[model samples]
Target: MAALQTRALSKSYGSRLAVDRLDLEVERAELFGFLGPNGAGKTTTIRMALGLIAPTNGSVEILGLDVRRHRSEVLPRVGALVESPALYGYLSGRDNLRVIGSQLGRVSEKRIDEVLEIVGLKGRDRDRVRTYSMGMKQRLGLGIALLNNPELLILDEPANGLDPAGIVEMRDLLRNLAAEGKTVFISSHVLSEVQQICTRVAIINHGRLVRLAPVAELLQDGGEFEVKVDQPDELVAALKRQQWGGEARSEDGLVITAAPDGRGRSLIKFLVDNGFTPDAVSARHRDLEEIFLTLTEDPVK
Candidate 1:
């Protein structure tokens, strides 16, 4: 079953449309990345899915429950940390978790400790949040969200304030959560991070759905093979003679889409027979950044 789905969902404010006829589905236990640029309606779509805001049209479903009709029933099983971390500065990390846990009924102190540890804050649980670093505060916010042991976790830019080490830790924590059967839906403008962490991705541009697919498949479509040869002109000529169409340019190398049926080896052999030795032959997959820039370069009407 899909953990979350949006069916032709749209949101508008007066004359401005934020999200437009968006359709997406995230499989159970999958880490689905939602990627878009600023003003691409990523946050608006997230708010609609969480029932934090009403959609102007269409519907959102969480675990088969309609977000609009069953928000109370659906929300409790989901945890979310959107945009920035909101925490009480005066409260210690442990106290913050305790406060959130209290609202979810009587949660034990042990459970709080477990969540703190999961976020790599076990040793700093007693420290006041004001003394915590930005990354630490972010982790604490995540801990608060996890207090109820939610089945679905939605995080928007979870790595925003994290350092390199902290980002790695956050990635591991997310992976572990998914391993434990939790569905993770994350929104990030950091395409490289999303490419590294998410198994599947849904891209949005100009408030409309662009594509949704496995990360590998998405990369495959944009995959290009770079071939550098000593005789660039001759290589281009030979390739054109054989009707092997590709974009050949001077300066660096020739970039061509990978053969559909894995005939790259044959192409290399053809190059060798034509007296051109390729200096480097490498397969390049488009990262999230490349895909985002390409897709969002022009506004959708």
Candidate 2:
């Protein structure tokens, strides 16, 4: 069974629809990414999935159990950190974990040690949370989420406030979790990190899913090629004259234009045939950030 699935899930406030009829399925042990612009209802959808709010329509299931109908059975198997994590400033990190662990039933000290080590807080686990940096606090929040050893983890901007080193660590940690047969669903604005970590991504816009595909598929070539020619302006002007290269433009001395039939060889043949001898030519792969902006710029019809 899928670790997480939604069928026509939707929500609204008065007459304003926050989430449209959305359908999604995240396989077990998959590292899935959820992306959207501000006010796109990402958080609202998450809240409904976690049973924190009632959906205006449809249903959400966690591990084959309806979240709203089986809250007691489903919540224990899931861990989540949405937006800012609430923490006690006066308490040490270890004590905070201990307190939450107690509520989850009998949790051992060895398990606490493991959680501390996993979050890179072994030595500093006893430090007061108030004295920790923003990154440290974020790590502590993650540690708390892992205390129960959940089968599914849903994190919202988990890398918030992390430094470069911390970001790398978070990436590795999440990958390891998925390797260990845990389903990880993440929602964040960090497109680069999402591109690196998630195998598949679903992008929502105007409370509707606009795109869903593998990360590699989404980052594939969009028929654009970069040509490092001597006279970039002249080359750009010439390329624009062609019906196939009207979108051509010069950036950083490189003439970028669409290739006929979306092939690099076709572009090279055209350039050579037109006497615009190219110094270098290569296909340009669109990144997740660029694709994201293009998808979210307008509402889906």
RMSD of 2: 2.3
Candidate of highest lDDT: 2
Q: Quote model 2's TM-score.
A: 0.92
Residues 1-301 of candidate 2 have per-residue lDDT tens digits of: 9999999999999999999999999999999999999999899999998999999999999999999999989988898888877788999999999998888888899999999999999999888999999999999989988989999999989999999999999999999999999999999999999999999999998799989899988887366888998889988999899999999999888888998888889999999998989999987778999999988986443
Model 2: lDDT of residue 173: 95
Off by over 4 Å in 1: 240-246, 250-262, 277-280, 299-301
Runs with alpha carbons beyond 4 Å of true place in candidate 2: 298-301
Candidate 1 C-alpha lDDT tens digits along 1-301: 6899999999999989999999999999999999988899999999898898999999999999998999889988999998889998999999988888777788899899889888999998899999999999999888887888999999999998889998999999899999999999999978888999899999898799988889988886744566787777776666655544454445455635343344668657766777878887767666767777887787454
Instruction: Give each model a TM-score.
Output: 0.91, 0.92
Show how many residue pairs clash in every candidate, following the order shown: 0, 0
* lDDT of all predictions: 0.85, 0.92
